[model samples]
Target: MLRIPAVIAVLGLSALTLAACASSPSSAASTSCERTDSDASVLDFAQASGDFGKPAVTLKAPVYVDSTTYTDTEVGTGRQITSDAQDVVFSIAIANGATGQSLVQAAPPVQPLSSWNSSYQGLVTAMMCATEGTRVVAAIPASELSAAGAQDLGVTDDQSIAVTIDITKVYLAAADGTPQYNDRRGMPSVVLAPGGRPGVIVPDAAAPTELAVEVLKKGDGETIGQGDTARVQYTGVNWSTRKVTDSTWENGASVAVAPGSKLAFAPQLVGATVGSQLLVVVPAGASGAGGDAATVYVVDVLGIDDPAATN
Candidate 1:
């Protein structure tokens, strides 16, 4: 739902192809599970040093490129980026390749590559397959830059830009755990796509009279405690029409929710473990649900994020 240029229009990156993209991305790309290997030599004109998150970049001004390219300078053993919608926490540095001038630097929020891809597809490719603690360098050609963004940055399409990124954390792409048994009668059913995206099928039955929950998948990770922020991918539908009402899949981003969150199922999820898939039923008269209609939610608890640690 969040696009690139739309964000830039807010922050003023007239030419930083991704200036607008920096706003937010509800986005992902191809289905290939293979790692995106790169040729590190392509970025010889640009170099980076100093600490991981705080990087100092030196570039040969007036750089030029005909295409976008990237390479990993350091790799971590943590989980890899499985899909475009996978959440990641990282810091980035942006610079003008042609003038060797630095632009903005930031440690952004817990978002998916899908969000960045919506603005600059090149950025997704640069971070693809990268694991936590991995450091990457990407060279983006002006032609690949957003026309409006580059124009605002005062960078000509013929000029290039340099970027250095440090990925600190990565979240699960889906609920990777053992399947759980379900014996609840008259409950909605959930089906998962190959990438672990879920689809719901609500039975033509009466909506529950109270808050109801069932675990469709169980994980071996830590149990969610009070105040823990659960990052999840979920889809919600109205029981009456069975038409979709809200979905992270459509947005290509996962959200961080608290226990008993009204935005989610409004039920306490204290004991739920990470990597668990929850089937939640919110009755029509439930508190704070606005009583539009009964709603069914299939939520994939991807992971738990420390609200303080995350941006």
Candidate 2:
């Protein structure tokens, strides 16, 4: 996958590129400030240098799509690529460089997007179509982004952006290049108690302590035996505050944990058993909370077929 530092790399290059353009006396303008027709050499350099531009979205998994127009967004530290819009949803964790003595570490996995209006679809769609290791640019009009997304991106009306996507790796169980599980949408809404999370607790008799779950997606018929790898989509929040400090919502991705690690998922979880729900309290630091405290998780098993995969 494109390394996280790639974002900084692209920004750095952008500065240099701007300086270079500003110094050169081109036909009409001095700076390559606006998106212009890319010549063969510029396109070739983008392909070789792994410079996607802006902030590129690197695909950890192969993205499948019918037809979508995407552009190069940005590059990672290793010069990885990223892309722009499409309606694909999947979650991923991004760790900043210099954490844990590593420049770029694998991030948490996320859930996949299936609905038409899923918040993450546009970004995913743009990344899915990009060639592996090559950065493609997408020019998205400001109106296409959500209000919060637009504001966060500093977007303006009639303004277009350059979204770079680098294909670091594409994982698919079959030759057709599609995920084993299909995306889901419009699930039955579950109301949460005043504590905030999803699903209400029954205070009456037979109040169950165990979690009740609904299976949404099935893995590739592989069994999640001991020592196997698993990716799960989860959300964690303070029981008292109900404020979600961490979530895979933006990417629809999951976290890969070992079955025996402090943050491991039970290895025995597999097959139709893949989507089975397990209710467990988030143990302090495990949920990004430093001390011993209670945290709730609503997890969905996305992949359980690979035992050696890094999330």
Candidate 3:
């Protein structure tokens, strides 16, 4: 598995988050299933422990796959995916259906559902209408694998691809990026569009003279600790101008933050619970940029990046 930074540096904000690959098990035995077709028997499927405490898939060996097929190894009881879902996050194990050799096994990563590419039809089908915690095994004909995908697997156009996907989370596309509710008065308001992008609405009154922090949404996951890497989506606005300085929402990705970054609001993020949203106000001269005007930030803490689990 390869660990890629969840976030990248961008204008106005110090950094942005991106997706990364995680590791998986090498092999496992397949479960008993009645083969519907001769070609289907060529591939055997099993579920096993993956890297970083995540679920992994094991294939016995590859066989000639003449057509695309899928099986629901486990059905989830969490949120049911709707057609309106904008993005899906899941882990996957991909291998050559003909040789049964592992191509790539990745931990959960966010994927857009609207991509209509023919090569991605297998993934799209596996995610559409699926619920959180669902485990799916899909076998795709070699013709269906995209050129890039085939190349990545080091297979020719004649080889089929088998993939197992574990659905972990799904997010509805934000309609206008506006928050549905607000409780903090005398503070700049925040609105979120689809994809968790935030828009700051500064109040007519003068910016607060001291640091102000508010929790827009409280998460129930793990608590963030100092020096721990955090995966988050956020937006920054200049108080006086009410203009967006930087935002991960615009990039359609979340970012991972390391400890001691120059971000003025990073300290406030520590000790915050996962899945919580924070709104912080940095008074003039407090933003560390020595500016005369203040800055407001809207942050959504997605999760704590596990340093040991990522790679």
Candidate 4:
């Protein structure tokens, strides 16, 4: 946890962090984020400057807020976080609004927007419209904090906390692309949930003798390069029993894997664009099942992860 409220009084400022290791998917996002002149003027009370993740701040005066308020100081050119199911890599620096004393500030942690909202409700609206590389400031009134949180931070009922949130990375909530047409004649059919999770329905007919590929949705993003690690959501079902054998959706997180032929469908996915959804059929041994049954996989190419990028 970063020095954010989740552990502020106990662990101190350096303890707040948004580690982007493993996390979950999205909920509907509000596009109606408001930025008022008054709020913007209030946010300006705290001047922040430094490297992106960890900000340096020197408050001009002790500030107070009647309600939650926020505004962006810098707008990033990267992907926008439009859904709660989406997870993000972010950092923070918070201080007691009435005392102008630092309380929390840390960098580089990852979690879903829903999780962040649960920890600091006031930050949610600001985050909804945030993009990778964004820097935003928010003021949370004491009323916004849980009674326990206010007590832990030693803030009076009328006091508040001001924080700077740096959004470094943004992960997609689901596959976003144009629908495709494929001859799924006797192949397993695929269906999608509201959040873009996929379900595979194995046909009651014989599995294909050779490898099979079907394009469920054609993405408009970058083409996945061979040997590149890709972020994805997938489900594997046994054609024989029509039972699911594996799924990333169950774990509530997307995983990054390098594309190659060792797993049968991995290589076939290399040329697929980010955001594309595919259905592939792998027979028994080829699927690494070592059984008589074949496996059908439905995968969503969420995005491509550059290994060199920071967490």
Q: Which candidate is the best by lDDT?
A: 1
Worst 10 residues of 3 by lDDT: 20-29
For model 1, the superposed segments whose C-alpha errors exceed 4 Å read 1-32, 60-62, 264-266, 308-311
| Candidate 3 off by > 4 Å | 1-68, 72-92, 105-121, 127-135, 142-144, 156-158, 165-185, 287-291, 309-311
Candidate 2 has its poorest 10 consecutive residues by lDDT at 23-32
Per-residue lDDT over 67-92 for candidate 3, one digit per residue giving the tens place of the 0 to 100 score: 66676667777555554224456676
What lDDT score is found at residue 99 in candidate 4?
88
Best by TM-score: 1
Where does model 2 exceed 4 Å of error?
A: 1-125, 128-200, 206-223, 235-253, 263-297, 304-311
Query: Predictions ranked by TM-score, top down?
Result: 1, 4, 3, 2
159-253: candidate 1 lDDT, tens digit per residue: 87788888887887788879989898999988877677778899988988888899888987778888788888888888998888888776545
Kindly give the number of clashing pairs for every candidate.
14, 45, 16, 15
What TM-score do all the candidates reach, one by one? 0.81, 0.34, 0.64, 0.79
* CA lDDT of each prediction against the hidden true structure: 0.71, 0.34, 0.59, 0.70
Prediction 2 TM-score vs. true: 0.34
Error of 2 at 303 (Å): 2.6
lDDT of 4 by residue, 1-311 (tens): 33365654332222123212223343633344433333687556777767888775557788788887777889888888777767667777778888888877765434456554544566666677678888888788888766656777677898988878888878777777789877657988777767677777777789987788888889888888876777777788888888888776666555666775355578777899977888888877775543688888888887777665332
Alpha-carbon deviation at 90 in model 4, angstroms: 2.1
